[model samples]
Target: MLAVALRHLLLLCLCVPATPPLLAESAAPPAEPLSERQRDQIDAAASYALATTLFASSDLPAALHAFERAWRWDPGEDQLLDRIVPLAVSLGRADEAIRYALIRAGDGSVSPEMLRRLALFASESEQWDEAKRLYELWLQSTPESSNAFERAMVRIELGRLYRRQGNAAEASACLAKIQKKLLAAPNSKASRQIITGLGGSLSQVYEMFGKCHLEAGELHLAAEAFSQARDELETDAAANYWLALLELERSQPLDAYAHLQQYFAAPGDPLGAAPYELLRKVLVKINDREHWPAELSRLREQHPDSLYGLQAEAETLAAAGKADDAAPLLRRLIDDALSEAAPIDEDSFAACGVWLLRHYAATGEANRVIPLVSQLGKVHPSLDPYANVIKAAISDNAFAAQVNARLRLVADQPQTNPAELLPAAYLALTAGEIDLATSIAERSLADDKNVEGDDLLSFAVGLLLADQGEAGAGLIRRALEQGAVDEESPAAWYYLSAGLRGVDDTEAVNAARRAAELAPASPEFAANVARVLQAAGQTQAAADEFAAVLRRFESDPDPSTRATLRETRLSYSYLLLQDDRVDDAVEQLQQVLDEFPSDPGASNDLSYLWSDRGLHLQRALRLAETAVAAEPDNPAYLDSRGWGLFKLGRFDEARDNLAAAVNATDEADPEILNHLAYSHLALGDRGAALRDWRRALSLIDDAQQGLLRAEIEQRLQDLARQAGVGEAPEKNPH
Candidate 1:
């Protein structure tokens, strides 16, 4: 009878109940009144059954509570005690996990797995002493049945914990232990299986050693360690990637390239686009850009169905100006991925769709783009609003009726997401249907509960970008009145400042000042105040404010904060130059370059400045090249590079880059156009120069670009005199 009872107890502890315990109790009740111990046992069993059910149903918190209840009712069930800690730990119930784990530890028979879990939990919670003690205990208690790799992983965790606590000596001690274990680990198939199966790779062990050496500034030792990590498992992608990075840091591009190629070719899940980007960096460093096309073709041929291959092919097609060839491949890729029963490769599908959309948008093929937009929304529903905006923005007058019908479809649905209505409003605004646009905007904001401050601000910014500032300002005011965001928040005031800048200068300045007051330490808010002051014609005040903000962030410890400061200085310099403070602007830009020599934005701006002034033409060209390399598709960077080349008398190169810049920009900037015109004139294409200059002149705002407008006018007169034609013969810029 005793043996049967013990077996039954064990069975109940091991098995998770599928049927409700209440149902079982009702079916078979005790004949007589139960004793306290018997009642407790029955209650414990019931609670355990409930807990397991909750766990299976994915109600973790409720499961944890029920598990705790079971433990409280019957503490003698040790197997039952085992279930609580893991559940508690998973649910982030730190106190509960620790309490139960300590109870098991007190028994001096806790399993090594439980001890390791406790150690990791302690480490994550930042309980330095507790974590170290638990880790040390785990290392000591690791069963002889456990492999060396498992023991080494425990030591590595201890080493990482020590590093987190800034105890370098203790960390080194842990690393030494791991290294000894690694050296002794057998190179047999069983040993490798144990290591890999247990999720502890020999490569990972060496990688940790490399990291320790690297952190200690022992570069040579770090390199050797990383090399050993790569050699330990020739197929290890992580080891190759780390070694490649180290080689790059050591200025060994050729070595990095070999390792990167091995990493790229390693069998694994597709590495996506990052490896290709890194490969490009190495190729650029070696000045072997001519090999790029061949390398891309080889990669594509080797892995035709992989993301890496597809990305390489896309870049190849784009570079060769073969969008027509790329279009079918991209469409097929997206179609195949979507039609598959397996999980889709979302990033690859989206990239293909974006490429197709961009090609259509550029070519003004609204009919083609609209269908693609619909297809994209199936895979990425979050992009629906954005896709709609793109559809509307690219559509011509011929597509206006189609766009209006889509808007009407959305408008008829009373409970549709308000975000869906914004594209229609934008479309109407662009189509010059002001009344319809206003009505759509009203409908978008009809449900205040559905709209938030971010939505309002985003739509306002969009409208502002589309040159409907009055409508944008109205939305901003409505958001403020509705208290969509906290009135006291700096962000609200900042939004107000931006929304009202051109509409109401005084209000904008006041709102900017309020934001600055609320967030005195925020460089962005402070910078905005300066910009607002400048826009309001308080030039001296703005300059003083800029100086103050610059001084404040000059000694900031955080690298990101300092980067923001550099951006602020860049903005200040641009504003100063606009106000004709040439010497001040130059000083500010020079200071920014001195502080951040390799910053792409600063490099591009300063390079453009120098080229415009015909100063340091060669140096400007170098800086411009750096910016272009960093962001190849950036129109502004391309314009800067073109201007630099033009200043250096490289007319052919300048013309190519300027033409690329013109193609890249969605709506052409007058300054970029003027630069392109300069390149044309330098190349002796007088007719082309006149045409571009006229286009630039038409785009320039007399209110904001008085100097540029005057320069274009003077250039037109000069060209007229040269051609012996009356006022340079007006031609339609379109």
Candidate 2:
């Protein structure tokens, strides 16, 4: 009975809470429970409480040990197993966690939260097979709890695993499942957020698909994938812009233009003027067919100061044949652009000048060219050559003369550009100073030692020498030997071949033939070769070549080339007149005058032909007067007028104009001297005529020496017979 009482005391000691101990050491030992069931219950309760504390502090190793001991004492404590499974997962023991989770999940004892945690942990550890299996178990055991968000997240994780493994098709299938679920429950905020988070991963999958297709050269499929991604994205300006660029790369300008317009209109896009400028070019191409006036007008109104808008307006007006209207707008744009103090690109400046030149030339508004020239002169000094040429076209003689004088000053300076000197030389030649022109041309060519192949400067000098009837053959040979004359160099070959023909070189004639063969499509080259062949006595070949040139280039030849061709035909007519083919020459001159009614040279030449042939002197005088008024300061036109007046018996007017032409410059022009002599002779001033004629003969070069000598001899004989003086011997022109 005492033993039984002690056992009961032990049972109480184990079951009840412990009492507070005294401070002194020496205390009696307390009895414990003797029943196994009570011992197990006490141990289980203590272990569970400690495990809870350990689990709360995230001490998974200790928590697992305590939980295992709890489970061992109370094997039916399935809740302890549930706690231990999650702790195992928290400790990165996913395999152990999943094993226990599956067993409890199968027994209908595991909570859905615990199963879900186990599956996510397995997925995080890249145990995709285990993660997938556990997720399936959870779904099967708790199908009612399998909502859209849970199912979508599980599929998204599987998709990511497949994507990592490079199984894009399988990955895409998984991602599609998430998309389908989200779409089906579009109003669910939780599902939408889940899908949105997964959107990035899905986008990457689409990008991978697009890139693979692109690498395989399947552009259409690649474009389709890119389109899918673009549609899925909420805010991706770069992606949209890249799609437009891809369209552009495929030469789908219309599609590209549409996409780019949309991109530019989108909010918060950072692509700047690049897209707008490209769109302008595309619009210009489409504008050829589409009447986009309102669209262009809107762009101008909304973005009045945008460079692209200005360019579009300028192009539209120019295309519509409203150059007069376009000129002011272009000027305003230039001013506005300059006022912005933005750094001017070279292209912008060049575009401004090019637009103005096109408009002014097209409308025949030569006066409008002056302001552009002046503006270009002030802003871009490197463009002085083009500016001076435009300035010289001004109707105001004083303004034109001022421009020529300024260019002369620039050309005379020691540090002046050698490239600019050639034009200045031509200006001097036109001003009737052959000696100064020759000097300038020679000096310019000498200074330009480093001139590149086929440049304008080298070609200009070669043409200048040839036009002057000087030793240009050597320059032509030098240019060709330097490889400056090739298929790409039409202008170079044209000028060099013309120069060689001037010197009667057989080698040059063959080289000219080669140039024609190289660029048969070049009208200027063909025309130049024809002129040379005619000069070299190959009339039939020259005629055939000219016919071919006219046939090919009649539609859209360069204006300058057209002018040169007209002048060449006029020259050929003059040659025919010299050959005593008077009717044919007259017909040719008539055709030229009919074709180019505004050509001053053709008018002057035709009038001179009429005067020389003694046909309709009054008409010749009228045409020559008109020519002189058109080009008031031109010495050639002035000479033509003076000759025409002399032919019409207006000797006094002729004398006055001829004297003005003679004193226009220091170096005498042979043609001007001849005109003055003829005027003096017609006015019964034989002595003055002889003096002028002798002066004219002295001014001519060796090429014209024979003609001058014959004229002088005839005049001398006529004077001797008229004045009762002995016949004077022939005097050498040299």
Candidate 3:
């Protein structure tokens, strides 16, 4: 059996192409001549053989573990995903499946089914934007011969998403397309069956239309459509659920109660106990506490085994500050799921573990928390971060020591998996073992062939934020070097450029320029090149690059691309303003307004610029008003409007707006405070003006706010000289 196993492992190793050694054998020390790549190949082959044997033996969990180990050792082997993705899906490890599927997507090998599943998972997780993107991508890849029902369902979902995003016109257009597709089908028995499955009935369509309006806040229209839908599909219970929601929104609790009753009486609510929570609300509104207990009982009976019941009970206990009462129930739910020989949902299952960990930690049960972390980590590798976090909280010194010991062991090994080291490195960083974490991270980067550049860059940024500048810059250089060889994509170079910022000016600009050269059609990449050039103080070249990208996207119709163009224009205008080109800045702002007429940022910025120059005071005030009306609570908008009002000699109104702006924000913005100070000075409150100016001056830094600081200081001096009282500040010490 051992010989046979060795033969299988040898065959697997032979089948896989040999990855290039991390270091050439000639360059390696005589004592340790085996390169990291050769060690990884051995590890991957052994793990793969073990995985295959376990899979044949029907030990799926062990098989999955072995497969993951193999893949971690051999990330460049794309074929390993063939087994990994399906196994993860079958094991109900949605996150794992999605992660590998995304890798396959990058390699352009993702299946339509995988894409659809990922989209649904995102939607269920309430990551609406990601869900919309995935759904759109899946639809684009789907063929015409795809199932009619599934296609219609996706269209309905798209319409629902559009409405939820407040794009009513797009939602309406989506519904029209769905209707048209059904109507366009051939008139035959098979066609009719397809249409019926596609939800072709007007009533069903109207119900979806009502949902769209509901999400888009067209409540009255939603009610009308729901009413029509309810009449046509009187027995369909779903219409009743929607009608109940509409009635609740309209504040007709009695009607809502009736509809909810019909909805509850129906066989099953696809929404689960979501409506029961609403019913509970309606009962409270109607002051009918008598039915509360019975309703709770009905819900408990509906979802037996204390599934929803235990969750609600735990929540109520926690809310009431009964931590002791909630603990057992939480433990029961967590233990039951863990002990059961059934497939588990990774996210939901791990969420319970995290909650229990939190509870245990809060109660000071480090013992309980440690064991639970061990249990949960076995079930989901993603829980490692959370487990390490909990362990650190329990004893940072002990955890750091544990990580250091593990690091030493890993270092002693001939080859170390970067994946295994990353979590420990992050935990060490979190535990304030900066040197140890940096060492681990450096070791991870040593084998650059398998290094994920994004992960390396992320760790580098983390180190930079943690005040390890030199070390961070070194890792960033390593990531850039790896990305240069492996990814060689515009986005990769652009991100690497961003990573190099504040570290190496020349390299950052070169990387950004390389990205632009690689993808001249990408406005974002080109804009990034321009921005980096501006940062490098090559103003003329920056302006030229900006102009090139703008001209390239001049007639582009993509909304996202147009938004990017608007942002690039704004950035270009800022660059022009910094160079004191007032007319050029105005032209850029005017172009922005022409393209995005109601854009509040452009309006506010333009108004501020015009007010600052004392040019077109009336138009600036109107523009400021427009911006304020759009984002009434925005401090910057209020500051612009107040400054415009101050320029117009409206001291009372200006002071009010300025004060409101000051009071609304947690931070005392120097510019806003300066405007408020001027308003106080105009109102003949020199003492108040002096105080505000001092506060503003204190907040202003000498770096970028030098001019503003000087102006405020001069104003203070003038006011003090006029009053002939206390002396003003002489100058900024720094």
Candidate 4:
């Protein structure tokens, strides 16, 4: 009886109640469920109550051990993992939970739900391999239990796994399967049902699929995926960033601009650095930069060691056409990256050095480039010279010859990093050794992308140089046939660009559309596409795209967006006014003024528009006055204000302001000079008016110019005739 009592106590200590699972919100759910047996056996063993009591007492670890023992006593009590797994998770012991889940799955003690629970747990724990295995197991449990949607989701997980493993082809295939499925029957009842089952969450699935295509360099496919995702489902914040990237790469600046505005407006993590970095690049490329200095300063302050921040200072200077100023900043970055950091970023240091040398070479500062390269790159023989030959060698032949010699020597070495061969190949190409360059480039291409698109870039350079001739078409075909990609290529758009270079316009556009689905790095590329579209008479489409671009800067925290938007509105309004679209022009200018009331340019534009049409004289005068107050020395703004005063019949004041405007521009602009003549006519300064008219008339031929110019010419002649002045002086520009 005493032994039985001790046994009961042991069983009691070995039993615990079920604890809840740690959430695996992002993981897959299982389809089939097995029958679940209660703790009847544990109850019969007399330890279940004690374990439950211990669990309630918050002695979780002890209770978990008790539950395990209780299950052992009654081998039929297979639900111990269900209780123990959650308990382990609750205790912040993910590894322990994984172990329990694995044991349950291994021993056939898991129901479908329990199995899925384990998979979710593993995934949430970032035990990706283990989670992947469990997901596959879940898929294999029973074919009938899982539907096509569930299977596709599993495929997506596999695709994600493949992507994570750097297997773009496999990832692309896995994702493409879903695309095919959806495309096969997009509006079918079955498809709709599957989507409904996922709570109309197919967009998220499509987004993941798009990401796979993006990773695989299938730009067009990515674009399609993103479009479906964005249009059908919830407006995901991260997806907006990807769309912005896509628009940039497509050269659809306006579209990218709009996406960026929407992206920043989303209540996502404000500290995310990618949006700002990409935007800076986009803005610089379009020469529509806003709040540039402050934006760069923010990046530096927030992410000093980040690639974006480190590159910003130099890139911004270069963008501003200040190569001399850029050189020092890059040099400083290189020096600091080389020596000051605790774990010096050797790669960054080398890249910066390469860039600085290239800039020096480009600007004809060859005397500076060689010394810098020698100190930066040659000092570290172990470093790759991929960036070395890219810019500098192309510009400076002497430096090229010297660097080429060392690069080839490095390539001749038995075990050099593949990156070293890149510069060697480039240098060989520059030297007219096409065959050698081709061979060396192939060798380098066989290596992984050393710096972003280096491998594909090498291949491209080689392809261009090898005199592949008409074989270019065949070569592209072969590339497609062989599924050959430059090593672990992340240059996804290259797939679209290369395949559709001159093949099929429809296909090219499709491919571009897909590429735009991902996070693109080239807004210029997007702008090119937009230009092509616009030239093709897709005016409305182009307009829509540009409108999207305008939306991008609307809600930005950076003042750059406001500045950019103002300029955009300024141009848009100017065009509208030129077209006699008075209402539209006013609305556009009103938007700029409403958003940036203090903007002198916007104020001047608003005032001038009203004054030009002889409308809203009082309001125009106030706006002009405000603009004049803001930019006292700006000739254009002063002219707008003077025109406003003249429209209000303040003749003498108009003359004074118009005189300043003429003097400010050295009387260069024809339109401003025309306005000054009108002001002089209003003030009865016949000689002054005659002289200004003569200059304006000499600068413009009535027959060769627009309606406005013709109007100005007629007005000048009328004023001269009325004042009884002689015909205009010959070639009097001053």
lDDT of all predictions: 0.71, 0.62, 0.71, 0.61
Model 2 ranges with Cα > 4 A deviation: 1-344, 347-511, 532-544, 547-565, 700-702, 725-734
**For candidate 3, lDDT tens digit of each residue in 174-286?**
66555556445546554466447656775776788888776656677678668777876778688888888888888898899999888766664455445766777788889
Clashing pairs in 3: none
Model 4 bad stretches (over 4 Å)? 1-448, 454-541, 544-568, 629-632, 663-667, 701-704, 723-734
TM-score winner among the candidates? 3
**What is the number of backbone collisions in each predicted candidate, taken in the order shown?**
0, 2, 0, 27
What's the CA error at residue 613 for candidate 3, in Å? 2.9
- C-alpha lDDT of residue 254 in model 4: 74
lDDT of 2 by residue, 295-364 (tens): 6676556655466566567767877888778778778767765676333455665676777765555455
Q: What is the lDDT of residue 40 in candidate 3?
A: 58
Alpha carbon RMSD to native, model 4: 32.3
Q: What is the C-alpha RMSD of each candidate to the true structure, in Å?
A: 29.7, 45.0, 25.0, 32.3
In candidate 4, what are the lDDT values of residues 404-511, reduced to their tens digit? 555555456657555455555544554555555555544543433442243434345344445542223233334333444432233444344444445454555544
Across 1-734, the per-residue lDDT of candidate 1 in tens digits comes to 22333455677578765688777655654347655466566666777778889999998766776776665556677776677777766665554565567666645466677777777777776777777777777777766567766776677778777777777666766776556544565575545654675476667767877777566555675686688787877777877776777787788999999988888787643446667767777888999977877887777676666654665667667778898887776776666666762233567666677677667656656556435544665555435335555555546555555555555655667865565565455555555565566566667667666555565566566666666666766776776777664567787678778778788999889989999999988888988899888888887788888888988866553445656777778878877887888888876776565444456887898788888887656667878887899999999999999988887778899889999999998888998888888778877788898899899988988899988888888887878786885444322121
Candidate 4: what lDDT?
0.61
